[model samples]
Target: MPRPRTGRRVRTLLAAALTTLAPLVFLTGPAQAAPAAAGAWTPAPAPVVSHVETDDPVVFITIDDGWATEEAAGARQLLLERRIPASLFLLPDAYERDRDYYRTLLAHGPSRIENHTTTHPDLTTLTEAGQRAEICGARDRQLAAFGDGPRLLRPAGGATYNWPYHNADTRTAAPACGAEAIVMWTHDLTTWGSWTPPTPELKAGDIVLLHMGPTLEADLTRALEAADAAGLSPAPLRDYLLG
Candidate 1:
């Protein structure tokens, strides 16, 4: 009877020992989580800033329309002198009138060309198919003209109607047409026709809008000066868009 009792006690101790050792085995080699799927690229959602912002002291200069040749010349010269990168939103038809002129600007390393639409129609008034044609068609035309596709789209009048019968406005359709973003004016200096420069004090990440004709040089110069005062440098629009 004493031997039987001792044997039972021995069995109990062995069971306890196995239980403790089993936990140690698990602790020594932890399981690894599975690796992310191969070739999977998850992109973040587009940012909602009116103009992209960075901690760096940089601004974006965006010119709209291909209307004023005189202003375009002045703007190009000023931008080159300042060593600043600028973006142009051109009307495809307007550009077709003088492709070489726009191409000359595009040849500059700091400048990028994008779309303003085919004929500059108010996109909010058109139908869905019409909207697509204007938005996507403008991109196609721009790509054909510049050899580089447009990554940004600016709608005419910056308006979007809510009715389903009418096409979504340029503001709404720009993203739909595969534009990395839409551009709107933060400052309008009336440089093309009036030649008046806007007041200084423009801050970093500001998107200053100007036109092509005669007063472009003065307007751009004023804007640039104001930006400098605000401690901001000009950044190319391409930096913010997908290549």
Candidate 2:
């Protein structure tokens, strides 16, 4: 004979059914809000530019480090006289001794100060946080000294060897520090010691690298002459890069 359904049996069955359906109901019904992702989101890395690709008849002049300014008076005059829109990747310590020198360069011409890190350390050797401090710290100091923030970063070292030393961290750290591009050089025209590097035929989008040294004036002249030969005029790097 079949057993009749009892109240207890009914109650137990109902409870079991509720237990089985509860999870499904919970899952299908309006979902509970999830916790937000951890950590603040950072922006994508800025582009690394060794040279600009453009059709304009223009070249870029970049002078690294603010040291040797005393011997670079002629170079300074050339920058002002020609209104060259040179990107000055100056260190804080480099300009601390002669704020007026850089000040005059920025005040009179289209030249603008860019970041070269606070201590001029090879950024590839640093952690992301260390690189950020070096880059962002330099920016803060530059803003204080020049009354304008830097838009470009030229990482310390790499020019002499014609190879840029930057890792993934450098690209990320630069944007975090407000840099739009990691500017390297297409041609290093800087005069080291008694040796003057041969000036290649300047292309329309070539980036020339010079340093503030005893030969900066001569270096600038060589670069300008090369540009003239190639029918390229010096243009503002910042404008071109942003555009």
> Please, what is the TM-score per model?
0.70, 0.82
Candidate models: Cα lDDT each:
0.62, 0.78
lDDT of 2 by residue, 1-243 (tens): 222235235434543453354322211111122222244434445556667777999999999888978888999999999999999999899999899898898899999999999987767678878999999999999888878999888888533433345666676678778887777777999878888999899887888999987999999999999999999999998877763
TM-score of 2: 0.82
Off by over 4 Å in 2: 1-39, 158-163
Give candidate 1's whole-model lDDT.
0.62
Clashing pairs in 2: none
By summed lDDT, which 10 consecutive residues of candidate 2 come out lowest? 23-32
